[model samples]
Target: MPGSPPNAPCSMRASICALTCWCSDDTRPIRSATPRSSMRSGRARSSRPRPRSPRKNGSPRPGPHASRPRASRSTARTGPGRSKSGSPAGPCGSIRSSPPRSGPRNGRAGDCQSPARGYPRGMSAPVAVALEPCSTGENPLWHAGENALYWTDIPAGKLFRFDPADGIYRKVYEGEPVGGFTVQADGSLLLFRVSDFARFDPATGSLSILRTFRDEGMQRFNDVMADPEGRVFAGTIGTDDRGGGLYRVDTDGTVTRLFRGTRVSNGMGFTPDLRRMYWTDSTAKTISVFEYDRATGSLANPAIVHAAGPADGTPDGMVVDAEGNLWSARWDGHAILKIAPDGTVLERHAFPVAKVSALCFAGPDLDQFYVTTAGGGRPESQPLDGALFHLATGTRGPDRFRSRILL
Candidate 1:
C-alpha cells in the first residue's frame, strides 16, 4: 500500500481515473449492490475540483427498504437444482437460517468432516508449514500444474510456494508489495500490486506490466479471483477516510469498475454451480452474494448472507466449498468459520495464531485446505503466526479457473 511501481505504462489512468478519484463532474452514478452505510470514501487523491453546495444533512437518503440488504433471497437459476438435504427445490431456492450463536462452538464439527482424521498422527489442529513467519501472510492460492501452494507476505513484498511432496517452501519473488495474484492458463502470474497490475513469470523471474494506474498514490490491490470465464475480479484496500473499489479486468483487456466505496474488498469466490458470486467487505462486516451473469460479466441483486456480529472477528479472505458453503478466515478471532448458505455456522476450526488471513482448497484431488496467517513480524509473535498451514480435509473444492487474460 505504501510503495510505488517502478515499472508501469501510462495507458490506464485517463479512462479509469474518474472512477476512483470521486470527481463531481465525471463521477457517474453507479448501481451499487452494497449499501451506502457500508461504503466509505476512497483515499485516491483527485486533482479535479468540484463546486460545493450547502447541505442540511449528510447526503440525501433513499426511501425505506430501497437499499437495505436482504437476508434471504432466491438463488440464481443456472439449471435444475436440489438442496443437499434432497428436498425437491426450485431453481431460485432460498436458504432458511437458524438463530445466530453468540460464540463459536469450539471444536464443533456440525456438518464438515472432523480434523482428527485429516492429520497424519491424528493431530486435530491446523499444522503450520513454514519455518519462518511472514509479516502479513495472505492470499493462499493453489497452483495445480506444479502441484504446489503459493502465498504472499504483503508487507515484506515476498511471494512464496510450498511443495508438500518434499516439504519445501521458499520465496519465489521479492519486489514491490503484491496484494494478490492469479495463476494464468499458461502458468504465468497476474500480479495486482500497489502501482499496477502485471504479468509475472516464475521460471525466468520476468514481469511485464499489462496495465498501470495513472496515479501512484492510489490504494493498492488486496484480493483478486478469476471467474469461470477466466476474467479477474480484483479489489483494493481502503485508506483512513475512504473505502476502496472493486474492478473487473476482462480477458479482452478491458477494465470495468463494478463498485465504488468498497471497504476493504478482501475475498471472492463463485458458487459450485457458477450462477452466483460471493464477496466479502471486511470493514462493513458483511459477506454479500450476487446473481452473476457469466455471458456479460456483471452482478446484481446483492444480499447479505452473513453479517459479522460484534464478537465475530473481521472477515478476510474467503472461498466457497464444493457444496456451496463458504469458509471465511477471521483476522483477530483466531478461527476459520465454515458457514452454510443460510448463514448458519457449520464448523469453527480454531488456530493458535490470532490472524487467520486466508485459505484455499489445493492438491491434486483438491482435498486439502491450505491456510495463511499474519502478525508474524510483531514483537510478541507466536510460533505459528505468519506461517502457512496445511490441513487435509474430507471435502474437495473446485479448482480456480486458469486465467486467460488479454485473450
Candidate 2:
C-alpha cells in the first residue's frame, strides 16, 4: 500500500489490488486478475462487465464466478507491453546483451593481437632465448673483444655476461641499480647508477664512484650514452611536483644541465655524422630530433620526429643503423618499429609479450638485433615476458663508441 499510486479511488484500488503485490518469491506466480491487454494499457476498468454495487449494510454483492480463484497472468509479456525495442526485460528490468562473437571488442584494432609468440605478421619467428628472467633488463652490450654479451638487471642490482662459445652465464657485478652504462676504452665499464656515476673495473672487480648527484628531490637517472668524443649525455626524472631535465657530463666530471621539462626521459642516439641527435620520452609518446653540437655536447632546434598513437605503444630504447634507420622498442604495443630519417615507418617487428623494453645491435658485424624486456610487474603466466631475444637482420651498424674517461 505504501508504494502504490496515491490518487486512485477505493473501487479502482480494489480492482487493481492484485497488481500491488511485489513478486518477492520468484517461484510463486504473480497474482493478476486483470486481462493482459488491459494491464498493458494500464487502464483500471474492464470492458466485459461491472460488478453490482455493495449492499446498503456494507457487504459486497457476490459475482457470478466469485467462488473460484483466478489464474495468474504469465510474467512474460509481448507486443506493446514489451520494452522499447520489442524485447522482454530481464529479471532485474535490464536489457540483456551478449559479447561479440568475433573481432576486437576492447577498442583495440585487429592488428594489435599478434598471432604467434616470436613471429609477427609478415615476419619469420626470430630466435628467442631466455638467458635469464630479470625484473628489469636493459642496455645489451656485445663485447667483441671478449666475444661475450653483458646486460644489467636494474632492480636486482646485478650485472650479467654470457658467452655463446662456452654457453656459460656469469654474474660479474653486484651493486646499486644501474640505469645505463658504456664500455670504456680500457675495457672497464662506465656505470650510471640512479644517483651517481661510477666506473667498474672488470679486471680487478672494483667499482669507483666518479660523480654523485646531491639533489634529493630529483628522481634517478633514466638513460645515458657517451658521444664519440667521450662526453656522457644523461637524463633524469623528476619528483611529483616537477619535470625532469637532461644533462651532459664532460670527461673532466663537470656536469651541465642542457634541457628541462621532460616527464620521462628515455632512449637516445646520434647520427653517423654526430650532427643530429634523437631522444625519446616514453610518457610523452614522442621521439624528437635536435641539431646537436658535438663540440659542446649541446642540443638545439628540437622537433618531433615520431609520435605514437594511443594503440601504437610508447617508444622505449632505440638505436640507429648504418643506413640511419631508427629501430625503436615499443613498451606496451608488443612490437618494434623501424623508422627512416623522414619519420616514415620502414618495418615493424611484433612480439608475443607486451613489454618490449630495449634493443641494440650486437655480434661482431653488428648485424644481430638484441632485445631486453621487463618482468617486474608482469604476471607469472607470461613465459617469455622478461627474457632476452635476438635476430639476425642482415644489417650492419657502427660499434658502441668507447668512453674515454680519465680514471
Candidate 3:
C-alpha cells in the first residue's frame, strides 16, 4: 500500500502475487513471526513506480531483513583455517593466539603469529625438562663423552649438569656468576667466572684460580669457546672505564687481546673448514663474520653478516651445524633461525617462551637439540620461561672438541 503505482489498485490479489514472486527467490530461511505486509513490501511496486521517502544520498530505505540476526561473534570464521578470534589449532592440537601487545616484554618481542605451516614432518613440539628452572640460563653444552648435558644460570651463580642415562640433575658448582665454561680434556671444567677465570675439578671439588681480572675494568666475561687447537676465545663486557674486548687465552694461560670497543660480546662459532668465524654483539644487535686463521688464532677482514632490527630481537648464543650452517638463538624473537653460510635465512623454529637464549645439539647421535631460556626480569610468567627444552632434529651435529688448554 505504501509504494503502489498511481494507476494500479492497491488490492490484496495483486499484492499477494507480487509478494509471492519476491518471496520465492529469497534463499534465507524465513522467520516465523515475519508479517505478510513486510513480504509484500520487498517487491517492486511497478515498472514506473515513484521512489518514496528517498534519503539524502538517494539510497533505498533498509528492508525488513536488514535487522536479521547475525552469526555469533564467537562462531564467525575469519579466514580459511583461522577462527574469529584469530587463534588456530597448533601442531600439538592446542589453541594458540597472539593477543595485541605494545612493545618488547623482557627483552623479547610479543608472541608471534601461528608457526609457519611447513615444520619438518614428524617433528613434535619441544619438550621441557622437569628440572628446576633457572633465573637466566645460558650456554647449553652437550658432552658426548660423558653422555651428559651442562649449562649455567648466570644470575643464580650456579652450574648444572644432567645425565640422561639415569635422569638425574645435579649442581656442579655454586659461587660467583659463571658466564661461560668449557669441558677440559681430563673431564675437569675451565670456568669463566664474574671477575676471573678458574679451574674446577669435579672429582675433588677443588677450585683453583687460573687468572684474575680484578683491575682490568671489565664487568665480567660473557661467552667463551675453545678452538680445535685448544686456544680459548673469550669476550668481556666492559665496566665504567672500558669497553668490551675479545681475548684469546692460549694453552699456557696467556690472554691476548684480539679485538676491543664492543659493548656486549656473546656467542661464537667456527665454520667446518675453520676458515671463518662468527661472533655476536648483543648490544649492537649484529652477527659478524671474520676471516679466521685457526692455526694462529687470528681474526681479520671483519664484516657484518646479519643485523637484527628493532622487532627481530637480539642474537645471543650460536652453534655451527655439520653442513656449516649457523643456528642462532634469538633472545626475544621467540625462535631459532638457521642461517646459511652466506647469511640467508634457511629455516626458523618457534618456541613457546619469548626469551630463547641458547641451544646445542645433544644425544649419542647428536640429533637432539637442547635449548635454554631466561626468566629474570619478566612481568608475567610463561609456561616454559626458564626451562630446558629438547626437540628431535633428525640431523647430526659435529662432535664438541674438548678445550685442550692446560690448567
Candidate 4:
C-alpha cells in the first residue's frame, strides 16, 4: 500500500509512501445501551495492524453491490417491518445473494417507518427519503446557503451537489478524488485531492492547487470542515493507513500542520458555540475533541471524545446540529448516533445499510437529514448497496460550515 512503512507507528512518513492512497471505511461503533460505561468487552490486542480484507486487496476492486434504477415511490408510508414471506426483514428488504432485478421499490418489503412514525424504541428504522446511487459515496455535507447537499465519491473521483429546490443535481467536479470539501466565502469550494488542497470553481471549470500535505505528497485528503472564522481544517490518509495528518489551511493559501499520525481521518465539525473542534480517526475507532481559539484558528487541550465499540462500528463522518448535539455515521454499526456534547450517545437510529459514510441536514426547514451510506469494501452480495438515504429527524444542524475566505 502507498504511504505506509512496515512496523511504523503512523508517523509523518511510511515506507510505502509511493503507493496510491486507499479510501475505505473500517470504523467500529459503540452500540451498548450504557453511556460512559464500557459494556462490550473482550478485545484482544494485536501488535500488527488489522489485515486488509482479501476481497479489497489488489489494484482496488470495484464496489461489489449494484443498485436498482430510480423508482418513484410514495414517501408517506414505509410499510411494516415484515417481509412478504412472513419473516422478520433485515434492514434491507430481502437479503438475496443477487441484486434486486428492479431498482429499490418504495413499499414496505423490510421497510420500517421513520422515528416520526413511532414504531417503538429500537424498532423504528431509518427511511431513505432521498438517494444518490453513486458507488463508494463517502463524505456528506449539507450546504444551507445553497439549500443543497454536497458529498464526494472518492473512488469515482467526483464531487456532487444536490439542490433540493427542484430536486436537481449536478456533478461539480470530476477526475479529482475529492473526499471532503468546505465552502469558501465566495461560494467556491476548497477540496483536497490526493494530498493537495485546491480551490475548485464549480462555476468556471478550474482547479487551482494550493499546497501538498502528508506522506510527502503520497496521501489524499479524506475529510474536512471550516470553522466560524473561515479556516479550513482537514485530514489525510495513505494507502496503508500510515502517515495521515490533520491540517489547517488559511484563507491566504498558507497551510499548517496541526496534528500528524492520523489513520484515515474521517468526520469533522465544530461545536455549536464554536468553542471546540471534534474529529474522528476511522480505522482507530477514536474520536478526539480539541479546545479551539477562534481568534487565531488554533487548537489546544486535545482529548479523546469517544472511542467507539470494536464490533459495533467505527466513526466515519460527523456533524453537530443546532441543538449542540453531535451526530456521527457509524460505518459498520448500520446506524447514525446522536451524541451529547460530553460524548454521551443520546440516541441511535439504525439504517438498513451498514456502511453509513457521512451525513447532512436539508429539506425546506433544514430539519430533514440526508445520509450517504457506502457498501464498505466490496459491493454487498445483495443489491441496493451504495444507495443514498434520507430521514426527517425534525432537527436542525448548526449553521452551515462557514466557508474560509479564499485569497
Q: Write the per-residue lDDT of candidate 1 for residues 144-263, one digit (tens) a residue.
A: 888777898998887776655544455567778899999998998888888688888766667888887632224788899999888999888866325576788899767787886655
Clash pairs for candidate 2: none
Model 3 lDDT on a 0 to 1 scale: 0.66
Q: RMSD in angstroms, all models?
A: 23.8, 24.9, 22.7, 16.8
Scored by lDDT, the top model is: 1
Error of 1 at 65 (Å): 68
Candidate ranking (lDDT, best to worst): 1, 3, 2, 4
TM-score of each: 0.70, 0.67, 0.69, 0.68
Best by TM-score: 1
Would you list the C-alpha lDDT of every candidate in the order shown? Answer: 0.68, 0.64, 0.66, 0.62
The segments of candidate 3 whose C-alpha lies over 4 angstroms from its true place after superposition are: 1-118, 214-217, 240-242, 376-379
Ranking by TM-score: 1, 3, 4, 2
Candidate 1 regions off by >4 Å?
Answer: 1-124, 214-217
User: For model 1, what is the error of residue 72's alpha carbon versus the real structure, in angstroms, after optimal superposition?
Assistant: 49
Error of model 1, residue 51, in angstroms: 92
**CA RMSD (A), model 2:** 24.9
In the range 281-374, model 3's lDDT, one tens digit per residue, is 8888888999989779899999988887676678998888889888888899887877888887766777766788988888777766778988
Cα-based lDDT at residue 31, candidate 4: 41
